[model samples]
Target: MMIQKQYKFYAAHRNEELNDKCSNLHGHRYGVTCFFEVERTGSLTTLFADFDDSIEPHLKREYDHAMMIHVKDPLYQTLLRHMKETGETLRLKCFSCPTTVENLAHQLFTEITEMGFRLNRLEIRETDTSVVSYTREDWVNDNRYFASYQIPPSESVS
Candidate 1:
């Protein structure tokens, strides 16, 4: 069985080096849809988890009105440290990659995966008509999980 949930939050971000445009600070009413696939359980209960109880709080705290920062940016690091020292309650994101819609989708996917949920897909809508989708398929083939698989002896014998 598969269940999907959607959430929205307003966030501000900028491309650290996008010179033409999107380099300046801008805000977006971002929409996020998270897909989850659960094992078949024999029960009448709802397969989808409660948004308010399970997901809303997280979105509210982490993303709502927050400044999404690309961690690799030296400027972001400087600002983050200054904010921390000043005791500012700033919701910041330290991303290893650039702060783009595509990276945002990947980051969300990673977070959901880390939380032990079987994530099917994550969609980050940057605009009403534009969005980026990241799926578990992208990460499943990554070399990070190579150690988890054991090679059969037939191949090794050669």
Candidate 2:
């Protein structure tokens, strides 16, 4: 037995490795579809609310309206310096790797699984026409190379 859910988030990112327009900072209305495997024995294998409880808050805090950037991105340091100097806040979700749809899928998959959900697969819709999918098997194969996402510490007032 299995269940599926769809979620949406708006975020900004750039692909530094790309030479095209994608290398420029841009935002997207991302769509995520998650599939979970459940046991067939129960009257309700899982409640839909359980999914929302686990994922919605994470999406809101980390990805929604946030700038998803790699720590090595030039803009990252500039933004951090500006935030410290001017005492402004920027919602930055830093990643050890590029903020690509594939990586996003892996990150979310790992998170959901770690939260004790039997996640079977995850799909990220980067754009209207571009989508990336990851399965449990894929995650197992690539888990060794996955780098966890990072959140920069707040600057101390001096």
Candidate 3:
């Protein structure tokens, strides 16, 4: 059996690898749909509520209303400094690669799968007209960019 769930998160990011408008910081209401395969246990494969319980917290904690920036982005340090000096709360999610939609999709997929879910497909709507789709096969075949990169402690001043 297969089941699907959708999630919405608002986050700010920029593709530092680009030279266009995408390089500027911006926010979007991203829509994510995840398809999962499960074994039928009597009449149900899994409870939708169970999915929500496991996934929602991760999204809220890491992505919702957060600023996702590559650890190397200049803004990354500036934002951290600002938050620390002012003692303000900023939900900053740092990444090792450019915060493009494609990378974001892959990150989410990896996170979800690591949670013990049999994730088969992931779709991310970066905007009303733009979407990125990813699957386990794609992730496996492609070079896992920044997959093992870790942010240095000095970079996280806050």
Measured by lDDT, the strongest candidate is 2
lDDT, candidate 3, at 138: 76
Instruction: For model 2, state the Cα shift of residue 71 in Å.
Output: 0.4
lDDT of 1 at 3: 80
- Candidate 1 has which clashing residue pairs, if any? none
Candidate 3 residue-wise lDDT at 9: 91
Is 2 or 3 the stronger prediction by lDDT? 2
Q: Which predicted model would earn the best TM-score?
A: 2
lDDT by residue (1-158, candidate 2, tens digit) is 88999999999999998999989999999999999998866677788999899889878877899888888779888988999999999888887678888877877887788889899989999889998889999898667554232333222111
What are the TM-scores, per candidate, against the unseen true structure?
A: 0.77, 0.89, 0.88
What C-alpha lDDT values do all the predictions have? 0.70, 0.83, 0.82
- TM-score attained by model 1: 0.77
Descending-TM-score candidate ranking: 2, 3, 1
Worst 10 residues of 2 by lDDT: 149-158
